[model samples]
Target: MNYHLFKRAAKLFTSLLGTTLLLSGCQSSPESIVEKITPLNPASDVVPVRVVRIDSSYQLQRAGKPYVIKGAAGVQHFEKIKEKGGNSVRLYAPAYADVLMDKAHQNGLTVMFGLWMKPPYEKFDYYDPKAVAEQQQEVYRQVQRYKNHPALLMWNLGNELDNHYGDFKVYQIVNETVKMIHKLDPNHPVTTTITDGVYAIPSIIHLCPDIDVLTVNVFNKLAQQPVRLAEAGWKGPYIIGEFGGRGWWEAPLTSWEAPLDQSSSDKAEFMQAGFKMTVQDQSSRCLGAYVLYWGNRFEQTDMWLSMFAPTGEKTPMVDMIQTLWTGQKPANQAPQVGAIRVANKLAQADLALEPNTDYPASVPATDPDGDPLRVEWKITRDVDEFHTLPQNRTAPETIPGAIREAKGLNAVIRTPTERGGYRLHVNVYDGQGSVSNNSFPFFVGVLDTPRLGIHMPQYRRY
Candidate 1:
């Protein structure tokens, strides 16, 4: 933070906060760190934000007004989100926290800033008081520095910590951190995202009640949240921190055992259904939802859940979300390329091919903008987890060589001479900065089960 920005934030603190008091510094006593960085909640002119109960329902009241979060979870494309009628953005970590806060404020978008917490999965031992206090010291600094920032909506304490986790002691840190935040900044509420509904909600209810609102990153299972929450005995306000298409772990698997990636249109349709079921269906405890991956990145494929592609082209999911938010679509839309088919069969079919043999593959697609589309085909090596290397996991296209012979919508793929598992990828590009992508996973030889070519962040082994 620079001098001018600090001055501007200080001005907002003067107008909104009751008392703009500064802590001495980011110092935490090893013996009692949470005690050292204590909280001070004075009477304020306005309640910056809080989760309020209304009869049998709940909603977010910000500045004395009911606010629903129509949000996206990424750092880029803030201007576009504002145009599409999104009022909030969720940051995953602190790398761009202050910068995104400033940008979000400029765009009139509030932020659900995510405080990156290390769980036992990352070998962060909650049992060790020294380590726990060191982390609290850092958290204290972050809250005190930006607590009065105008764009700060809420603090997401952690993300999905209960997935593949076994430590109950972590909640103590969470509770202590939330306690510190409540004292330092009373304007915004603190939330910790974990595996949703039946799986982790109960533990939070039992172990961590200091969390003001329950935030979840659910997928296709979003519709089941009501039952799951009820079963877990959580009857409070909640927000869909992240939601999109079905994850590859849940998607249909090929005979080779590789998960088939959903088409661009398929993802948009799934997101549309999810948004309707949860946000639009309008559960009493349900606040609005946030569509995910505002920028493009690879999990299953190059463009599995990203709202925008690497070329800065928006996906159809973007259009669907805009429609859901504003009841209107974009002036220009992305190309709707249905599932890529192999041998005139869908990718879901048993896509087993001979080694080094030519196969017929094509993706039927149409551009809504009527921009001439360049359909390019390539061979991607989607290997099992045993063979998944760093390069292949991060950048798939750079491996297994390109199918130079394969061009246009209709193309013949010359398979690799020796392949265990591979994928036929089709990427349709419109000259107008839009792209539609899909992939078909197939085996080289007769194989029943190939390796899983996916990344599970929760169960990462050290």
Candidate 2:
């Protein structure tokens, strides 16, 4: 009996089990760890940006004017954002603060200026007085630089600092930073975002006295945001810093452990639900909500939660946000691609196809205003930053005439010669800049060999 072999087998089994649990949401790694106020102290004699109770509800006011933050997360499409009834944009960094402010002001929109902070996992130590003092000084400089800009709405101090730090000193630093900002620039309020709605919450509530608003960035549980806040007894005003479609962590998975995604319409429905739960519920503490990844991002999948496609094609979710913001639907609604059928059959999870096989794909689509619909099909590999390993993404693989669009509803797509996962995406456009897309993922080869029990050939009962 070899005890070393048995020990190695046990260690490998435990490691694999932990990884499985992490991926299954039953466990998480260590170190993964809100509101309000008045015109108290009158730090700068005049504070224009404030949260006011308006008819039993709360609204963020800027320059003594009622302001509901119809904000998007990204800053690329200011014109489209304005046209879609968005009045603000949230930035995560100050690199292009000047340019963004100019563009947002031109578009009749305000900006939620995000102040990037060093996470606890980073090089800086919040406990170190010198480091903290330097950060405070830098924050003051940045605030003074942009505080007078008309497009500046409020100061978002740090984004999800709790994710990596469970230390109470981080919030203390945030509190100090807020105090400095109030003294330097009292016109704008200060806020810090959280990934978890309720985390080290007591410390945040008690320690961070100067925080004006408690912003939360949520995903799958976004619809239950209000409930969670209430459960945590968080009475401070809050904004949905970011809420998108289903989060990749909890999304349904295929046999290959890849996350199954929601269709565009389904995503729009989730966004609507999120808005209803957080922003439109008429709660006094609810100010407004911002959709995450307003523009296209390569997170998990290209179509994960972004309102617009990577090619600048607007999805139905855009119209959903516009309607929610304006209380009226867009004049020209986008086409809806309800479902996609591959090879005249509906593949429940993912369609498995033979290499170099020809498969026909079609979508059921309709335009809202009875406009003519044009369906376009494209094929690409399922490799993405979130899902694929870094080593596996060495180079772009050739799809090899993967999809050939037909004249009408159907298109014939050829499977890739390589044995891997691929996707067939369909875009239904109304010829009026409104578009809806659906993607069907397919595997080009057989599943990997199933794992048997852990083998320790040299081990035996002692």
Of the candidates shown, which would achieve the greatest lDDT relative to the real structure? 1
- Model 1: residue 449 alpha-carbon error in angstroms: 7.0
Prediction 2 TM-score vs. true: 0.79
Error of 1 at 432 (Å): 3.2
Residue-wise C-alpha lDDT for candidate 2, range 1-462, written one tens digit per residue? 599978866755664454445434521211110011122233343336887765655678877887778889986788988898888899988887778878888898888899888777555666455455556555656776677777778999988788646655688668866876787676888999887548656788888978888998887887787888777777778988988777665665454544556678878888898788778874577778787777876655566666787678788889899989888998888887777788886646445779888888888888889989887777777754444442354333436588765755688988888888777777777888777877776778886666222222221101
Give the range of the ten consecutive residues with the poorest summed lDDT in model 1.
Answer: 15-24
Model 1 lDDT per residue over 1-462, tens place: 999979866754453232112122344332234444332222432239888888999888789899899999988899989988899999877786767888998899988988878866668866555566667777766776667777778999987777557545577568767887788678899998876536566667777889898888888687787667778788888889888887665566655557768888888888887778777776678877788888877766767778887778887888888999999988888898887777688866666678777777787899988889988777777845434532467756544444636657888777777768787777888887678888888777766544443323332211
> Which candidate should be chosen as best, given TM-score against the real structure?
1
TM-score of each: 0.84, 0.79
Q: What Cα-based lDDT does every candidate model obtain? A: 0.75, 0.73
Instruction: Find the 10 residues in a row with the least total lDDT in model 2.
Output: 27-36
